[model samples]
Target: MGITIFEDSYRHKGLRRKLIEELRRKGIRDERVLNAFDKVPRHLFMDSSFVEFAYQDKAFPIAAGQTISQPYTVAFMTELLNIKPLDKVFEVGTGSGYQTAILSELGAKVYTIERQKDLFQSCQHLLKMLGYNPLYFFGDGYLGKPSYAPYDKIIVTAGAPEIPKDLIAQLAIGGRMVIPIGTSDLQVMTTLDRISPTQVDIHEHGNFVFVPMLKGTNNR
Candidate 1:
């Protein structure tokens, strides 16, 4: 795989500012989340072919049948997590690493996993080039990173048929998780706040679309 070259120019920053305003208008009130959108160069995470639409509030296809999620979706989910600086975050479906960069920007120590090897490697390289350091792993997202259990927060980027029990088990007491759950065609954005050792408060936010979260790793 050749190195994907990207430039973060002044024009890109201006577009990002506009994107932030659009997100605010869409009801994303978290200041930190908005600041992250301002800091990360969204265009750097997209293929050069779709660079023009990078700052748009829309999803774009990436490698391995995945997508860089719409900006509002990212902000909505990130806001649900209510991330605190230096919080330990476990992320499923690293995809384009754009969301991972946002988590890192908000001062979360993110541990992200990806099942597709191509996306895993490419996203790792791009994130490094952009200087956003988050621990990366290639594995099945259905099985949350057990070795690093008790995460303060967890975010799943893909749409799941149901919430994975292992993910809930991995959350620390009083931890939070943001995931999209429902069918492959459409999903409801849900937030699970672990209130006790055995209790979690689940809240449904709204509807969104995302790639299906597959069960196992794709070595191909």
Candidate 2:
């Protein structure tokens, strides 16, 4: 995938502004998250066919049976992470790279992994085109990126059956992780605050439905 071209027209900006307002009303009070949302053109992360629906506060299908997460969900999760400048972030399930772009915009060094080879390649190209430089990996997300251990923050975009011990182990002391855990039908948005080497605090926010966190990579 070489350089690609696309236009972010004034109309798109206007719709995104309206989306920002919608997110604010729905309890997404983080201004930095809102600003990141305002900057990244969601349409560019979507297929050309779904471009018109890009700014809507809704989830839409992307490649490899994954869906670009709803804007509200993304904002909610980001707000929970409490990102700071230069915080090392490891992201599981880099679907479409929209959330990855958000993390980058918020000044985090993002390391993202995708199980689907197609999404991994396409998102890598698109984020690069948009000038976001997160390190990208095409592999199993369940294993987490251990080489980049001691991450200041970690976010899992997919719903896990339970908390992944590997990811928890990679977090830096006093680091935070936002993940959704439950069955395939639904999940509870959970956050883990690593207090010490053996002690961690777990908290649940609310319920959300996400694509299941799967093991291994899919060539398709």
Candidate 3:
């Protein structure tokens, strides 16, 4: 098997510069976040049918009835995480692996868990194809990945009944987690900054709607 010359050629004369400029105009201010968004090709993570909308700042459905978060939402969440080069991030929902890919681009070592087996497998393949280094897993998104405990940042992509105690316990001292909490149809996006063993700060971003995060993982 040989590499495609046209693929390399198109990449050189690619769609990225325009994408970066558009994202900037949309107010994605963090240069590092922007660079990550710029580097990971969103179109590649999506189905061919939706590639045209890849850079349009909108969410699109992938396998397993999950969506690739809108670019703005993904950037907003990632920015809230306040990723540092040394941060080890635990992503609660793998979705289409778009957010995980973006986090990887921002230089975080990502450990993401997805409940849907098909979506998990698809995303794992996509990330590998894109040369992203993420530790993808199949399991409930609720518990978070305890094996990689004490993460610097944790982000939940779906709405949960409450902030899972399991995930909070897994947060490193002084680390932060950005999550969505409430019923499936209605929720609040919040950032929890842990100051100590018994101290945390909550900054809630009014409202949002997300799929319910189910418990009882099939992980063995």
All models: lDDT?
Answer: 0.93, 0.94, 0.81
Candidate 2 Cα errors over 4 Å, as ranges: 1-5
Kindly report which residue stretches of model 1 are placed more than 4 angstroms away from their true locations once superposed. 1-4
Question: Model 1, range 1-220, lDDT digits (tens) per residue?
Answer: 3443566788999999999999999999999899999999999888899999999999999998788999999999999999999999999999989999999999999999999999998888788888889999999999999999899999999999999999999999989999999999999999999999888999999999999999989987
Clashing pairs in 3: none
Q: Against the true structure, what is every candidate's RMSD?
A: 1.7, 1.6, 2.8
Clashing pairs in 2: none
Tell me the tens digit of each residue's lDDT in model 2 across 95-147.
99999999999999999999998888888878888899999998988789888
**How displaced is residue 148 in candidate 3, in Å?**
1.8
Q: What does candidate 3's lDDT look like per residue over 5-122, in tens digits? A: 1132354325666667777786778899888876777777788787666677677888777788777788878888889986899998888888998888888999999888778777
Instruction: Give the C-alpha lDDT of model 3.
Output: 0.81
TM-score of each: 0.97, 0.97, 0.89
